[model samples]
Target: MVPERRRLLSRRWFYLLLLLPGLLFALPLAEEDLNAIRSVTDFYGQRAGKRMQAWRELIQRGKQQQWDEKRALTEVNRFFNQMKFLSDVVLWGKNDYWASPMEFIGAGGGDCEDYSIAKYFSLLELGLNDEKLRMVYVKSLTYQQFHMVVAYYPTPAAIPLILDNIDVAIKPATQRKDLVPVFSFNGSHLWLMKERGQGQLAGSSSRLTLWNDLRSRFSSEKLKRPKLNLDD
Candidate 1:
């Protein structure tokens, strides 16, 4: 995995890896997709250009500084939580859809799943082990609706920290009593959650249809109306 290679290489070599084309653009916005972002935002009159510029700065700052795991959690959770939440029907014109991180930022709004997806990918890009982060599906007792969040395990056994859009705070899973875990997943594994967010390994995350669709469309930006002002 990239994180393994990152640990083996010196800090000097790690920075060089960032330069490799398509290896990972700090943010994966292509010129044409960016143009489309502008076109849609023109009518809305929000500064899409400036918002993206701020995102670039976040990526740069995160890379230059050696951030701790908790610091990485705070930085990423706070950044994307700034975006508005909309239903899948409103944002993507579907009953249920999952957007990639770039698509979530490009459109300026998405549902809970979007917040989790963006955080999961951004954390990985920041060099966290893929195994340490899992996207969890939970039943929100407060709202009586299904919701999603990103859980960060310092070690596989550590009580995971919850990164959620609704709360927009990094708290331990034990503190999130309102959320009843149903299951969890990442790129490699799927888990069937038992009581209190603990999970039993199920299978590959490929079992998730929406997640697979999101990955397939990640490189190809699907232009939607941009409404977020990141600088705001």
Candidate 2:
């Protein structure tokens, strides 16, 4: 009887050992997933500071230039254009490429995507409706790897005007098929792969599950990191 009891105990221990391997494998994957989400959150949170500054600048620029919709877009274009192409190149290569507008303004520099994001939020502050704007990720005809730009859609199904670092002219989206749209997102929603979808289908996904985490990081506390002279 004692030997049978001992055999049963041994089998219990073997089963427990089998469970350990699965737990070990799952632990790292869980951490990696969490880290990826955290990275996105960190990116947006850092930009919050720059976003605020950009908005303030926009307000001043509007007052100075008698801001209207067309002028606002032009002024935004001009502001980004002044940075030239080099900034965009550097920003793209850096693993820490772009920050939120708040972080970007505080840092004083960012890649093309950063400029686009800044302008998007600035337009929002200026009372541009969310439906009219999208931050689009695209493939550049000339450059390798993914690139980002803003597409302003004045109405649903209307062609969008592309704001690009490579060119100053704001052209229609259809004019450039070189830019195969990977995804389009606005301030409130991230559209997977395309812009059109039902409202009920908009928010359900593990992909966008990181948004709340990203949003929380945008609080003022995160923006208080000691400012660096990003111009350098």
Q: Write the per-residue lDDT of candidate 1 for residues 65-137, one digit (tens) a residue.
A: 7687778888888877777688877666788888776667656668999999988988987789998999999
**Residue 46's C-alpha lDDT in candidate 1?**
49
Give the C-alpha miss distance for residue 22 in model 1, angstroms.
Answer: 23
Q: After superposition, how far is residue 194 of candidate 1 from its true place, in Å?
A: 1.5
Q: Model 1: number of clashes?
A: 0
CA lDDT of each prediction against the hidden true structure: 0.74, 0.57
Residues 150-196 of candidate 2: C-alpha lDDT, one tens digit per residue? 88877776778888777678888777766767776776666656532
User: What's the alpha carbon RMSD for model 2?
Assistant: 21.6
Which portions of model 2 show Cα errors greater than 4 Å? 1-55, 61-66, 84-98, 194-217, 224-230
